[model samples]
Target: MIRTFGFPELLFILDGAKWTVLMSLAAFLFGGLLGLLVALARTSKIRPARFLALCYIQLFQGTPLLIQLFIVYFGLPIIGIRVELWLALITGLSLHASGFLAEIWRGSIQAVPEGQTEAARALGLGYISRMRDVVLPQAFRISLPATVGFMVNLVKGTALAALLGLTELTRAGQLMSNITFEPLKVYATVGLVYFAICLPLTLVSSRLERRLNARG
Candidate 1:
């Protein structure tokens, strides 16, 4: 039963953007936390922690996100485990983002001058205090632009959530296109919606990068 691509369909598709926003937020918040831990572990003095963190990063970063999403949604059930759509999507995206962010932030941390760490050590600051009070702040500023860039990609990654029955923007567009028999219009709208969401972040990332360079 085909229908027309009209105002109502457009509104419905736009409404689905909310879910995309939610999923992106979920992935970023959780993934950022995980990435922080991973970054710390990667930089840890412990050989085992560094090795395990590296393995985790390689496992996630080396794989395609679509395959990871599939493994979460479909593979878990095969192993006698089941997760709801929201959890599954967040898990996949968060793990993906964590890998990249951990590496990104690790670089940021390393980029901070060794002299600062030595000064912190001279001041009797423990490793935790050194990182929390001295290092992470500088590293965060350095990593900000790259972090935002990754987040822009994560926003786009939410489109993949549609594959697991989530009614995100892309999925909504697909469903509308099916009924409206208007793939071109519906998908064009979807692309426009994505552009609208990502363009600002892209601009913001670039601006921040320029500022960082200016400071340097």
Candidate 2:
């Protein structure tokens, strides 16, 4: 079976890889938008806002992604609201990623030197102005490596969406293997595609982090 791995099967796997990349990008972009709001809420002076952000982060992060997917895909219909598998998968992945990304960005903001904020305040910058002019720009430099790493993880996590019946790379590999009776070759191809997607990002992230550190 491994000896019989064909171009057709390999192409099918590559097609699935494209879907995985698309889903990952969707999850990351939507998650990043929500995560930024959550990060700001967590850092806000209002007690209720901070508490709400904390709860949002903790609830999602404390739950397993598989369980979250199940809740979205299966559990929602119980309330008379039906969601398509792809839609549910995207929602679950984005929400999960948002929780983690929020925390990551919050930590990055805190890692910005205290004096930067203080200096901004002394310059008569308001809260928003301080963040925009002084804190967030520097924090973004520190955050880029972590965000890239999270995106890689998010891409890997798209495989879990297959469990919800969204035909991603892993699910496509399973289907091909079942049809071809070539599990080893099929799975190996799947892994190679994933690595191909991830390894370059990993290298780029490492290089960027090094450059950032050197500049600082």
Candidate 3:
């Protein structure tokens, strides 16, 4: 008798998707904090801080996340530091997001006219005060769209966590496909679920970008 894909299995898939969303949220919140610090360091006048940030961005951006996952999941255990697959995946994705985000924000911060920084300096504002009161607020507004876009990408990237054995959306699809013997259907459902999650974000980012541009 041929087995059919059923509602119970579909519910399981949906349940798995919740974890995917949660993991993405965790990755982004933690990564955004790290990225902000890296962005500041990248823009620092100190040569050592600048070099450290540059190397961090280069290391993560240059390597595929798959390899990084393997290193953390498998290789780290060799050194007696055993992290669960979920932990490893979150750590890897957070690091990857931080590297790219730092660059995006650094560019946005630099795009602010030099005269703006100079004008702040002319007001007797210290470096931290100038950046806090003047520079970063403007820079954050300019970078908001790109940051949203990055967040969307990070959501999709959670599928990669499946390789580390976390039962997220894609991995759940694989299990469903195995049982139902319907790879196309299972993966199509997975893709649709991902689209449902990501589409609104795309629309929101576009609308925000247009509004920002119009104001400019």
**lDDT, residue 163, model 1:** 77
Per-model lDDT: 0.92, 0.90, 0.88
How far residue 185's Cα lies from its native spot in candidate 3, in Å, is: 1.8
Q: Between which residue pairs do clashes occur in model 2?
A: none
Query: Where does model 1 exceed 4 Å of error?
Result: 206-216
How well is each residue in 1-216 modelled by candidate 1, as lDDT tens digits?
789999999899889998998888889999999999999999988999999999999999999999999998899999999999889999999999999999999999999999999999999999899999999988988998889889989999898888778999999999999899989999999999989988988798788778877885
Which 10 consecutive positions of candidate 2 have the poorest summed lDDT?
Answer: 1-10
Q: lDDT value for candidate 1?
A: 0.92
Give me candidate 2's TM-score against the actual structure. Answer: 0.93
By lDDT, the best candidate is 1
TM-score of each: 0.91, 0.93, 0.92
Cα lDDT, model 3, residue 53: 97
Error of 1 at 72 (Å): 1.7
> In model 1, what are the clashing residue pairs, if there are any?
none
Error of 2 at 43 (Å): 1.4
